[model samples]
Structures are given as structure tokens and as C-alpha cells.
Target: MKQPNKEIRVLATVTDYTRFFGLPAPAHPLLTLIDLSLCRHLPRVLTPVVQQLYTVSLKRDLKGLMHYGHQSYDFSEGLLVFVGPGQVFAVSESLDTSNVSGWMLVFHPDLLLKYPLGKKIASYGFFSYELHESLHLSAKEESVLDSLLLSMKGEYEQPIDAFSQDVLISQLEVLLNYANRFYHRQFLTRRTAEHDLLSRFETLLAAYFTQDEGPSLPTVQFFADALHVSPAYLSDMLRTLTGQNTQQHIHQRLIEKAKQLLLTTNLSINETAFRLGFEYPQYFTRLFKSKTGVTPAAFRVSAN
Candidate 1:
């Protein structure tokens, strides 16, 4: 029996994406601002799609499921969701488009050409976050973003001028900066939940290290997956709380375990490396020296 193809679709260009939803072609080849309210006739997407574009979108009173990453969110309040190039998006159920409010700013990488945002945009960690971890906006926060978007839209409607790209890019940078600020605020205000996730992360770290068998080395992705957050989201949250990212925390734990083995166990340094899940002993030795100012052998010698 022939099974249907489940391969994800790719909407390679902004025009293709706009056309797929029966919208007018974009004014610029590389960028577009879409009002979600106009998308009342969106077609069902039988397969998931990956778009090679960057999008910063706001949604309000949206109905039904729009899947991004592994989690689902109820967008009853104003919220922002970002999607970078090559992220998959799926609409599992039809949206009640009549009540959908907000705009989506999408642009190709080329649109950022010769601008600082082209490079600096990579630093915006929220772009890599999952939808369920979206930024919930208060009314005041939403107003600030809306005013900025209005400026961007005014520029977008103007005919192509030498300063059009420059104006657009400037407004975009401001929008992104404000979103960054708001995300930081979100982290601080949601202290209870953030700390809970932190505690869960620590517990998972301890359990992984204390495994009697198969003590596989942990990666940031592993911890993020275990904690049900994106890798970027997990690291950002940890940094906000502890001033150290996930990798640093993992290394701290690993080093503590190394010290414990050196002091209490009869295992050779080589054996210690393997037991700690290091595939190569020299790498472990180098890491120990870097973190603790001594190689594993020297540490064991000095401690005794």
C-alpha cells in the first residue's frame, strides 16, 4: 500500500508565502508587513511548511492551534511570536480570523544587507524560541510596539527611495530592541515559574550525574528537551536567574563530579574520564585544568 507523503513543504519566497494565503504580492521583493485580520480565507495546510524568512509577529484573540516547535499556546491575550529562517509552522486547526488582530513583519536575510541588523539580528535569542514560550504583552507594552510598527508601516507604504531601506531597517532595529527589553522584563516578573524551571533543571542535572550506569555526557539540548523548553529559551532563562548559561552550569556540575571521583574513588585518571562520560582522557584533563587550574592527575596528587 502506498502511504501519503508526509514531507514538509517549503515556502521559499515571500511572494510564495503571501500568495499561498491569497494576499497581494509584497511591495518589496524581500520584505512584507501583513495584517492578520485580512487573512480570513486562509487555506488548510495539509503538511507542515518551512519558510526561509525571519518573522516577528503579534497575535491577539486568535482561535485554534498554530504549532511551532513542540508546545501549544493559548493566545487569548496579546503576545509576540518570532520565527527565524527554516522554522516549521503548522496550523492544526482553522483560525477564527475575524477576531485575529496584529501584524507580522517578515523579511529575508538579503533585506538586511549592508546593515548592522543583518549581523546583530543573530544576537536576538528570542528568534530561536518556541511559540509556547512567546512574550505575553501588557497593554502598555503592546502600545509601544504598535507605535513602532506604525512607523515601519508608513515607511513600507512609501515608494522605493534611497532612504526607504534605511528607514525600514532603523524602525526594525528599534522594534527588536524593545522586544528584547520586554522579554527581559517577562523573565523577571515570572520569577516563580522561572525559578521552578531552574529547580527542575538542577534536579535533572543531579540525577544525570548520579546515574549508576550509562552516565552519558549532558548537552544543552538534552537539558532543554528534558525541561520542555527550547535550547535558546533554557539558556536565556538560566542566564537571567544565575548569570550563567546552561553549558556553564553543566561544566560546573561535571567538574564537581570529577573532583569527587579524584578524592573518593580509586579509579585512575583515564578510568575517571570514561566514567564521567569523556570519550577521550586528554580532553577531560584539559577541561579540568582550564576549570580548576590543575590537570586531573595533579589534582588527585595535590588533594592527597
Candidate 2:
């Protein structure tokens, strides 16, 4: 029997994007910013979905829904969506191609290493949010972002110097901070939607830790799939409401379970570990020590 050759999907690198749109290669291979106004849309040429480097797109005059995973959402209201590397994205026909405006900032993770932004970026939560969880901006807010985009464009066009990278990085940070603020405001102001999300989030978290039916702990995607939301959306919403993301929320619940076990049982560390879905007792011990600064046995002894 002859085996068929698998087709390799085209992944867009920085250079590929430049060539695709008739723009120059980026000064830094790891990151680039493109002014939407300078480019023309060729919707027919684009793939239904593409795997590429991370892209942060801020757009105006966009209509129709943006699909992230299984969800469909409106982008007509100046929305912001963060697509991580390798995530699939489907581009629809622009409702008014002539009116397309805004900036697209694309960066590889390598661009942020040895910097504080790299370390703290994961803490921001929005990167993990789903497409429908996109931030909707007001006209005034859009103006503020446009101003920052203009400043960034200035940096990109200038000569490369000792200060160029630093300047651009600072601008990127500023933009992200403003986004953080806007997201917080969105969480606070959109009470009906936010509250509904918050309620659903609590229910989902409770179901996971309840341990009533499952033999093992749920993977992040398990809950995400159940909620019809992305893991990032769940994490971001929890962070907004409870000062914790999904992973942290899971850890907290695990700790609570461990506390109850220590107080009520004569089970050994291994026994408790197995009961809590840990495949290895040592793995369980390490997590317990990391969270509580005490090993399971030590905690049991202290409690006794």
C-alpha cells in the first residue's frame, strides 16, 4: 500500500507576511507592526485559517463576527483579539474594505526574553482570552489607542540605534497597559455580560473540584470545552472577578482539598495523592510544598 504525503500547512513568518502584502521585511525578525491603512484587503487570497506568530490586531470599521474556537462574536465595535502562535484564524470578507483602519502588531516570544515584560505578560490574562472575549472600545478610547499606534509607527520608520528597541518595547508596554485598563473597565461596566460569565465560571470551577464523578482531574481544555469558552476567557474572567486565573484557581482548590484531608484522615501521603488524582505521590508532595511551604507528612503532623 502506498502512503500519501501529508501537505504541510503554510505558516507565515515575518518575511512571509511582508512579501504577502508587498511590504519591506521587518528590522527585527521577531516583531513587526503594520499600519492597516497602507495595505489593501484581498479577502479571496487568504486562507480560512492560518497558523502564524502571535498577532494583536486593533481594527476599526470591521463588521460581522470573529470566530475563536467554537464561538462567534461581533467585531463591528472596534474589538481587540489576541491570537497566540499556531492558533487558527478565519478571515471573513471585510464589510467595508475601504474603511479598514488600525494597526496590527505581530511579535514572536523571542522578542521579550530577559525582559520584565516577558515575565509579567502571562499575568495579563487577555492573551489567554477567546476571540469573542475581545475588548470593545469607545470612540474616545479608540482615539487614544490610535495616538499610541501613531507613536509606534514613528519608531518603526526611524533608523535603528541603541535606543530603538527599547523605545518600541516601551510603546508596546504602554499599549498593553492601556488595554489592561480598558479590559478592567469592560469587566466593571458590562455588568450583565460580565456577571453572567462570572456566574458560569464559578459553576464550572466547582464542578471540576467536586470530584463526584470523574476518576481524574480535568485538563484545562475540559472545562473550557464544557463552558463553550476558551481557557483564556475562563482564566481572564476569574482574574478580573476573584484576583486569580484558572490555574491559580485550580491550585487554591487543590490546597483546600489537601487541608481537609489532613484534618480528617489517617491516609498516607501516597493515599491522599491518589485520591486527589495525582499519578505520583512525589509530584503531589512538591506541589503541596510549593503552595504551603510544608510537605504533606509535615502538615499532617502539625495538624495532629
Best by TM-score: 1
* Candidate 2 off by > 4 Å: 1-9, 22-32, 40-43, 48-51, 64-74, 93-96, 108-120, 212-214, 258-269, 285-304
Give model 1 RMSD, 1 decimal. 2.8
lDDT tens digits by residue: candidate 1, 133-183 = 899888999999999998888899999988998889889999999999999
TM-scores vs. true structure, each candidate? 0.92, 0.78
Superposed by TM-score, candidate 2 places the C-alpha of residue 147 at a distance from the truth, in angstroms, of 0.8
Worst 10 residues of 1 by lDDT: 1-10
lDDT tens digits by residue: candidate 2, 163-234: 887887888899999989998888878878878877876687677676733247556677677777778777
CA lDDT of each candidate? 0.86, 0.73
> What TM-score would candidate 2 get against the native?
0.78
